[model samples]
Target: MPDRSLNADTVPAAGPHDVPKAQQAVEERLIDTVLQSFADCEDPRLGQVMQALVRHLHAFVREVRLTEEEWDKAIEFLTEVGHITDDRRQEFILLSDVLGASMQTINVNNEACGDATEATVFGPFFVDDAPRIEQGGDISGGAVGQPCWVEGTVRDTEGSPVPNARIEVWEADEDGFYDLQYTDDRVSGRAHLFSDDEGGFRFWGLTPTPYPIPHDGPVGRMLAATGRSPMRASHLHFMVTAPQLRTLVTHIFVRGDELLESDTVFGVKDSLIKDFVQQPADAPTPDGRELGDRTWARARFDIVLAPA
Candidate 1:
């Protein structure tokens, strides 16, 4: 007890590796414990996924030396995301899109089959049972924007027309808002129609315009905090399906959009970028539906489906 108050000479000197080695061991042990807990998962795939997830998650936390406060903040952010999600709004998908996770998953699942239209992110705005339209009918459904004539032919990988293929199209309006984003029960800028016997279809829709992904929520906040823009390149969504053919979900991005290189969702593909030919106000409309003085646009997107 008389010598308990030790001087520097009496105290043990610490090596540079000593503290880190002990901390590393503790972190590894925790990771091992979490992995073991998932070992008994009934599904083999689930067990594999859970174990891998735990490993990576632990590694991330360790690499960053994540603080308790940071972890708590993350949980709080996710809670807000869940709270804001609903049938019409999907904050999680927005998060995944912005993080490039959505595009990565799409790239993994969608193999590059020769000449098949490349697939892209299935955005959060698609809704089932969209109003059907006849060939060359208007899909605008009273949504406001510049008129655009969209036409395309559905074909198989073998270069043959695929008739009766169902095409679902949806997009945001000039204001960068989907029909579902409004307060009322309104449906516009979305419709579904079947490819004709000749595998051809056309519809009047709005000219694809640059729009921000819903940026008034937690995802928006994250984008701001990270100094990232939420602007998506102008695009038109398409989901084409037919019997014995692989269903294709993709978008046609505006060819010259400045944001094409930095689309918030990473949804642009070189093959999917197409020219939207501009028309003079006096130019005749595709379906002879006249717009007194509005300058419209036209885009042709030929789709090639792979065998299912």
Candidate 2:
């Protein structure tokens, strides 16, 4: 029922007189040669992974009927991606994000953690040792955007409070630029705070705005070439950690944002979506912050963490 001539294993060896093996056999042989070359790797897992990678990668090449010119261009594009990478910019991660590998890997590696917030791409903007602020403090750092109030609690899967949980947050400004995007100032749009005894934390931030991923480098060129938009839905990034609990690096997406279904990095999930309610000036602020004549957005995002 199957075509034997195209079989990778049983195809006749190439020779002048015998019926010529399928050209596909040449590709299969190349895969076999590379696999054999790595067969003696000291690390069993590494060897297996490499062999599988070779098989799948070769299969994709054959499936696409890739051309020599296209392969060379791909090599050049990857080289450009590497050359553009540096301390501040991560072109490779951007590439992975756009190609869906980042989210796929997250799904496979983090599936065991149940009822916990789903993990997503840790985009390149995360910084170490963000400034610590108190509950009810604002992380906007004067970045200039529509006002927003964010309140939430950290709880375990069983609905118990996770007190003193460390909550780290960051986001971009209304103009689609992060604090990292500014050379003169790299401190806005990020903060860390600890939850109270009741497992509650509150803060002030800006409403999430749709913004394009950093697309000025090779990643941007690739997006343009592939006819894909670089826009990510409005979201607030949160990384929550507590003793004996798993850390969650995730986003709280704006419920009605137009780009929710088409986040550039494929990070949106139904569980992560939340309604960002718009409030008038007379509405009572969660923390009683005085707003005499201002309208703002409010969103509540309670986090559930799994055990480590």
lDDT of 2 by residue, 33-124 (tens): 99999989999999999999998888777667678999999999999999988887888999999999999998887776567878887898
- TM accuracy, model 2: 0.90
Q: Which one is best on lDDT?
A: 1
What is the lDDT for 145 in model 1? 96
Give model 2 RMSD, 1 decimal: 4.5
Report the lDDT tens digits of candidate 1 across residue range 122-190: 988899989999888888889999999999899998899999999999999999999999999899999
TM-scores of all predicted structures: 0.92, 0.90
In candidate 1 the C-alpha lDDT for residue 146 amounts to 94
Q: List pairs with backbone clashes in candidate 2.
A: none
Which residue pairs show backbone clashes in model 1?
A: none
Candidate with best TM-score: 1
- Global lDDT of each candidate: 0.90, 0.87
Error of 1 at 127 (Å): 0.7
